[model samples]
Every structure is written in C-alpha cells, then in structure tokens.
Target: MKPELENIPLVKNEEKKRFEIELNSHFAFIDYKETSQQISLIHTEAEPELAGTGAAAAVVEKSLIYIEESGKKLLPFCPYVFAYIKKNPEWKRIVDQRFEGYDKL
Candidate 1:
C-alpha cells in the first residue's frame, strides 16, 4: 500500500530553505524563500524512487498548510505549485496579491 500523505512528517529545514519529507531514504521537498509578508515557493522535487507516488503533492500540500497557518502571502513560483493552487482555488486566498499571475489562477 502507498504511504499516507497525512502520516508523513513534514520538516522545515530552514537552514536549507526547504520543507522536506523522507520517502524511503530519499526526500521530497519544496524550495522556498521567505520575506516579511510573503514566501516564494520556488520549486518542488521528488526523487525518482518517489515519483508518481504523490510525494510532490504531499510536500506542496504540507508546505501550503504551513504558509497558511503562518499568515504569510504565497508566491507560488514553481509550475507544479501554480497548477496545484489552480486546481484547489481555495488556496488562492494565501497567494500574494502582487503576484503577476494572481488573477489568472
């Protein structure tokens, strides 16, 4: 059976500026940069072993949850994150209003 996304422990490796989760021996992560009022989600990645296993989505979800709880605006710079937010419109609330593509999402 596939692992549960909710059961995965998301770690904010602030030193690395990434939120990470272990998948087997590898990690799925979202690269981000934070400012006083906004966080730019720069990229998302999952190892080959973790691909197609929802790892990327899991990381994105957890990262978005964290951003929402922190009350910071989000600039979803990565295409995957952008598509994910487009699919889940409710997440748009956390998007930075100044983002060039905010209205497009």
Candidate 2:
C-alpha cells in the first residue's frame, strides 16, 4: 500500500556524507556511495505514534530526488523501501541496477 506522506522534512549534511530527517525526534538516513552513484537504505524507524504515517516514504522520496539530481541509483536494502518501490512503479528508473532480489517480493 502507498503511504500517507506528509510534513516530511528531508535534510542532508553532505559534509557527513549522509542525508536524514526527523520523525517525532527520531531520525532516519540513507547510506550511500557517491562514486558508484548508489544509495543503500540503511535503516528507518519512527515513534509508535508515527507508525504507518508515511514518514518512511517521505524520506525515501526525498532521497530519490537527490539520486535523480545526482544521476545515481538506489539500493533499497531496507524492506520498507523495497515495498515502496513495488507500490510506486513510476520510481522504477531510480532503482538500483542490482535489484534483482526485489522481483521475488
């Protein structure tokens, strides 16, 4: 199912080589490799109250925009991200080249 994305704040600290956001004070970020132009979704979690609020999708969407702008691909290691890709076929283009594993899910 597509998530109910809202009020998401995407932030990046390039100096730290990471991009992140706050969901009820808890943070999430995507682990990436600049040279290979690949991003691995490292982790994501929200306060119990924020669960199912689409905070994960919002963070992923923002990161995808960054990938598109940087001419890179995404490695959705996190299961939530993998599921998001399945729901949003339009975002297939930015999917990582090695995403063969997702076809089974």
Number of the top candidate by lDDT?
1
Task: State the lDDT of candidate 2 residue by residue for 34-92, as single tens digits.
Answer: 55767676555554565766665677778878778878777777777677777777777
Ten residues in sequence with the least summed lDDT for candidate 1: 1-10
Task: Give model 2's TM-score versus the native structure.
Answer: 0.69
TM-score of 1: 0.94
Task: Write candidate 1's Cα lDDT for 1-105 as tens digits.
Answer: 245778888899999999998978889999999989899999999999997889899999899999999999999999999999999999999998999999999
Residue clash pairs of candidate 2:
none
Q: Would you list the C-alpha lDDT of every candidate in the order shown?
A: 0.92, 0.67
Model 1 spans > 4 angstroms off: 1-3
What's the lDDT for candidate 2? 0.67
Segments in model 2 whose C-alpha atoms lie over 4 Å from true places:
1-8, 14-18, 23-28, 31-34
Find the candidate with the highest TM-score and give its number: 1
Clashes of each: 0, 0
